[model samples]
Target: MKKTFEVSDRLFELYHRVHRLVNESMTEEGVSLARSKFLFFLSKLGPCRSTDIACALNFAPRTVTEAIDGLERDRLVMRKPDPEDRRAKIVSITETGRVVLEAAEHPRKQLLEEIFSALDDEELDALFDIVGKLVDRTDEIRKRKDEAEEAAQIAIAR
Candidate 1:
């Protein structure tokens, strides 16, 4: 008898494959995924502190610093003292960075379009709905985990 597949298993496989493809494709485009994501985030958020970027990306502070250092050396980003927080520095993407980001994103966008082009409008809508539910479920799980941890800590204090 043939084995039935689970949705979670399928989702994990798809996620892994897509992630690997993205990494490989980005490398061929002469940019690391981390750098591309950083540039994209900076573009969206404007100048932000290195710590903020680290928090948003769930990366270590040192790792974020190193990435910013490399971008700074490439002249793709500038580090300036934060106006509101003198001790912290904000990293801002340069015009050159914007150009590079746009170039890198064009191919990625095209690849996504090509991949999804086969799906009819209904299928696309269904996929979106399913993905949204998955996102919500993930968030719920995370919140429950957080609450459990908090409860455990409170019990330990008593």
Candidate 2:
């Protein structure tokens, strides 16, 4: 008998393939996924601190520092002392960064549009609905996993 979970397996495969495509496309432009994400975030959110960026990106402070260092070195971003907080610095994208981001936006959107162009409107809607459901389910799973780990630690300590 054939396995029943083939659809799920195929979904996972598609997910990985899409991720690889994005990485490959971005890599050709000489940027990693994390760097691209940080640049995009900075473009959207204006100046933000390293700590806020780390939390928003779900990265460690050290990792954020490394990315920021590279971006600053590349002249894509600048770190200025936060006027409100003397101890902390905020990162701001440079004019060059804005130009790069604007240039990247069209190609990225075009690529994704082409990828999804095969689907009809109804299919596209259904795909989005399914993705939303999956996101909710994943969030619940993460919460449960965290709670389970906490419970296990408590049990071991008692």
Candidate 3:
């Protein structure tokens, strides 16, 4: 394997290791990483519909509904009729949810800090720059792939 492949593999393993540690820490505080994402979104975005959460999180409506149901059952979130659309209910984080979310966030942050503290300031800056470039390239490739697929579909239709 090329050095690039080896580096990629190491990065992948490191990511999973870090993620697992963070999840474990958060779980000890009574929240999973997935649950934290929803709580964080609601805490930041204020009240919104399940459909809104689905779009924002790139989850299916059913998945968001199920998650919201669980959160509601736990008294982490609440739903009420939307003022603008009576047919839809808006979801919001309760004070209890906020408290739990904050608690969960602490362990996640602590774990990340412990992991990244291995890197000095200069190394951290370089890593951020490299990661940004990789993300940008990935987005560009995805956009081109999407456009190519769209063009192929158009050609086939014609």
Cα lDDT of all candidates, in order? 0.86, 0.85, 0.94
Q: What is the lDDT of residue 49 in candidate 2?
A: 98
**Residue-wise lDDT of candidate 2 within 1-158, one digit each (tens)?**
24537878888898788777766766566665567888899999999999999999899999999989999998989999999999999998988877766666666666688889999999999999999998999999999999999999999999
Model 1: per-residue lDDT, tens digit, 12-116? 897778667766676677666679999999999999999999999999999999999999998889999889989999899999988888777767777678778
- Name the best candidate (by lDDT): 3
- Ten consecutive residues with minimal summed lDDT in candidate 2? 25-34
Better of 1 and 2 by lDDT: 1
Give the C-alpha miss distance for residue 25 in model 3, angstroms.
0.7
Q: Against the hidden true structure, what lDDT does model 3 obtain? A: 0.94
Q: Please list the residue runs of candidate 1 whose C-alpha ends up more than 4 Å from where it truly belongs after superposition.
A: 1-5
Q: Estimate each model's TM-score.
A: 0.87, 0.83, 0.92
**Candidate 2: regions farther than 4 A off:** 1-5, 27-32, 150-158
Model 3 spans > 4 angstroms off: none
lDDT for position 144 in model 3: 100
Tens digits of lDDT, candidate 3, 16-114: 998888888987998888888899999999999999999999999999999999999999999999999999999999999999999999989888898
Lowest lDDT sum, 10 consecutive residues, model 3, at 27-36
